[model samples]
Target: MRYFLIPALTAFLAAQTIRVGVDLVSVPVLVLSREGRVVPDLQPADFHLFDNDVPQAFVLDTSVSPLSVAIVVQANQDVRAYLPFIAKIGNAVDALLIGEAGEAAAVVYGDEVTVAKPFESGDLSLALRKLAPDGRNARAIDAGMRAIDLLRARASNHRRVLLYIGQPADHGSESPLDELRDAAETYNVTIHAVALPEIGKTFVSDTFSLQGLSSRSDRGGFKAGTDLGRLIPTVARTAAAAQSADPFSVLAAATGGTQLHFREQKQLEDAVAILGIELHSDYVLSFTPKGTGYHTLRVEVDVPGAKTHARPGYRLTTN
Candidate 1:
């Protein structure tokens, strides 16, 4: 018995530290055309990847593997109005997590983020229902950061998608934007933002007024309303500025993901469908850089007589 136990322990230790050859790093490069279509026919030779401005050799691994995704839903008042849009996301959830094994995805709402389904096929509607309750005080940026951190801890050789289901807001986040960006870069997590179109001008105006007045109420509610009326343009300008510098887009772009905006409600389903297909269709490439510091990587595809859209760059880990 002692001899058998000794061999088993040795084998377990060896398995825990097993490293694959240089040919097995699984970094997937998802190539999207300029028109928001995924180009699946591109071969390994068609791509040229660079690390720190130095060329690195890579291989395309097209094998099917489990995917881990984190869906951060903004549950603010603005997001609540788009309940149907949220419902459509439930449909997308069904499409991805139904049959895959070892696949885990969660829904983040307000200050709380919960794992709805863990890569199983049945009963995802419960998770969708969990996302329905709107949190009056949830912050979008904070939720995004939480999702990123969660995915980073659960890193895998398979693909990871950080799907954000609303606009960007930087309220009550303790981590700065730069920190979040660094974490995303380190983990190679691709961000997909679904910007819900403006529900209505009145909705936006009312939401803004309410947010401002909530900060101060000792002087009387009527006075707060008057003050907010005076500052309406400023509020509008602030919101506009916020949208222009969309944190979701910024995170997506920084980590080789695309940001999509849809005005019509039906388009949400289309976007999620596109995402599901892209997850299974991309080519994974791997390479080792020349030095040991942070290195920028650029992936390009040389498809003759065709235009391609790929990530501008990636920060390669060199430790």
Candidate 2:
């Protein structure tokens, strides 16, 4: 029979999750310089947080807990060509993001939401290999909700994360987009995505920029953190590029996560590596929220030439 997070990883998870055990709203913040390096040696006193534009007292939590990731794939017939390349990424994912103590679960969505792999420790790529295209409908929202439901039961000591792999748009889903959006905050799950383009759509590679070191560095004109305000907007956008009602972009932005692009095997593997780096090199901030309903969050880094990215909002309901 299958199991949850392995026993060997339990000790590691606890050691990394040291924090006050109360009603704390934890937010993971990513601070990067224009050179594409994470800002190091930051103190709690060097930052400020605002809820709905009102400054609030908070504490910097230095916890790097093992990740509990839910990998959601859109396995519709339209994406049949992309499955072969995607299936071979299990070992890379197992080595990088799932690392030492992290656990992962896989979900594939088409006409129905299917759990390809339960939360486990070893050989994540096999989960991808099992994905086969089914019906024409792409029930991405429904599958995402199922992923969240799986993670909600996991221990709080693990940082919950969700990764979506599919086209930009959704075809048919029973759950409304708003419901899935709210569930992410309620469960404190960070959302990231590997977005692919729809078939037969001619895409230009000229506009894409990889999220790493600038080629300008070789030209002796490298800038450091020019955009200190590249933050998530409070309201998720209704469109992404040329797609109608892009759910992946909306979900990624709303949850302070990134939406990466991939067209071939190499780009897909590179996206996995970049994701591992971004997840491992973030700062986690925690605060005890006062009231209920919807809460808007804003974070500012005190360091010079440091840009910040964090979840824009969260929701709570007192029982």
Candidate 3:
């Protein structure tokens, strides 16, 4: 057997009460076809459960229990600047919490993670509406770690999910990416990220490109061959762009979650609507692992041309 171990396993165990034991290996799976439609009717026989490549028997839990969702929002200055122009997130929040048993927590992140509103079974639109941006920096990576911790500790049997809405950047985070990946697997938390890009934001490159400075222009149209004045702005823009690239996809992929990107505010609203349906359509699989440590989970549909989207596997903390 090939053993793949994650670093810092002991530290992760010391931090939180991670789900373990032979019976707690619950895997949530989403079945989809090649044409992008959700395949909802798959039986236990369709799935081949494995713990470290060893086949095992498992049961499917497609219960319609109340969903435990943490809405982690990024509230940096730039995102807050265009907040008014964007469509009301309340509509999106409303779409997610459609059922009577739906519960949600509103967490806003900047330099630090703040649970603006803890999990509540009531409607979250009002609380989300009242939320505003704070601090100068964004710490999406750190906030994500905190979100997973919150969902794991929640005293509910309902399916746990994290809805991250923010620009894909981590300015200052106490946790590293590897640790975050471990945390997600440790808790079996599913993360669905919605990338919120700034609209109409001005940058040095935008200005230079507007003035006939193309990539083909080696000197960037500077008479001195290089404008010292543009250096800082150019570097700043480059760093910002690099940071804005998708940082949460790995966590999403590891957690068997989907990542949605929006071009328009309306598209965000529509995506949220679609997510509402997907949440209710998931199938939860519970299996008893033979032992502890990290286990690989592969869920496939017997149907031809069907793709399965699920977390790679889970890491059970064993003493």
Candidate 4:
């Protein structure tokens, strides 16, 4: 049986009211081919959107809008060991700011999360320099939630997106996944997670190795002739660590964001290149929710073999 910290659907489905004289909900969607290439020039009629499972009136906004991006970097001991690789993140920022009016902010998650740089359009050399990894407790989930909240407050007009650069593991997080999902939907913030498994090598490699040994000992006790007594304790201790590899991926999917896992430094660079192009080529749709209840969203395109990716839904507040 699986249990979630936050009521998954309810947390994301906050009630939202029609603002001012408008009752439009804006959704940004990415249309990609099976090969991961962005498909452009999609017409409004090509899309069919359902709000709370009800067909809704909608329009597509394909104009190149300015972007407000929040970059979240994890700063834990394991990440610190891979500083040389983390330093390359500076180049990724350059690739991220593709639009003429794109602006970005950086947040570092260590013992405590800190806003390393306020939103700016110019060079990010100084801010990147200040983001050194050092903390023992890397509250990745908490820091990510705070970063989303900050982006929610500061970047309302622009297309808001969070670029999370770290391992999926959260050692000490005050904010739970449910709250984070709620905030992401409430603010219409899209998350793009770049998982650096190499940075947290010690934790991932060692912890999982123990888990594998424990599993083998259990399954092949007779043939392998391993001690079940010692292995059971090892499995119990490393159980929490096993869950660390999947949180960011889940967060990304829930918020209509993409998760890229990189094994080599070059893979990260290549993934960033594709992401930069995809970021500039999203379709924004506006639709009004049917009622002031929890609403689910679905986007379908008429293009053959084309896939559409967007947020699952948002909360409609009765304010």
Q: List, residue by residue over 74-180, the lDDT tens digit for candidate 3.
A: 87675885454232766445434334455677777886788876774444666666657677788888888778777877755656788888776678888887787
Judging by TM-score against the true structure, name the best candidate.
Answer: 2
Better of 1 and 3 by TM-score: 3
Q: TM-score of every model? A: 0.68, 0.82, 0.73, 0.74
Against the true structure, candidate 2 reaches a TM-score of 0.82
User: Which candidate ranks first by lDDT, i.e. highest?
Assistant: 2
- Residues 1-319 of candidate 4: C-alpha lDDT, one tens digit per residue: 0112113211211111111112467777766554334455568788888887777778776544567778888876777755556566564555344333567878888788888777744355567666676668878878887788678666445777888878777878898877777777777777787777744254321111111112232221111112212111110113342234577765665667766656555555545544554465567788766566557788888877666777777777666
Model 2: ten consecutive residues of lowest lDDT: 219-228
Indicate the residue-level lDDT of 277 in model 1: 45
Which of 1 and 4 is the better model by lDDT? 4
Which lDDT tens digits does candidate 2 get at residues 1-319?
0112223223322343323223688878867664545565578887888888888888787755678889899888989999998888887666557766678999999998998888844346777887889999999999999999999888777788999988867788989988988899888888988888887775422122223333433321112223312222222333452143778777887788877777887767766665665676567788888789889888887866666778887888785
Per-candidate clashes come to 2, 2, 1, 6
lDDT of 1: 0.51
Model 3: lDDT to the true structure: 0.59
lDDT for position 251 in model 1 = 72
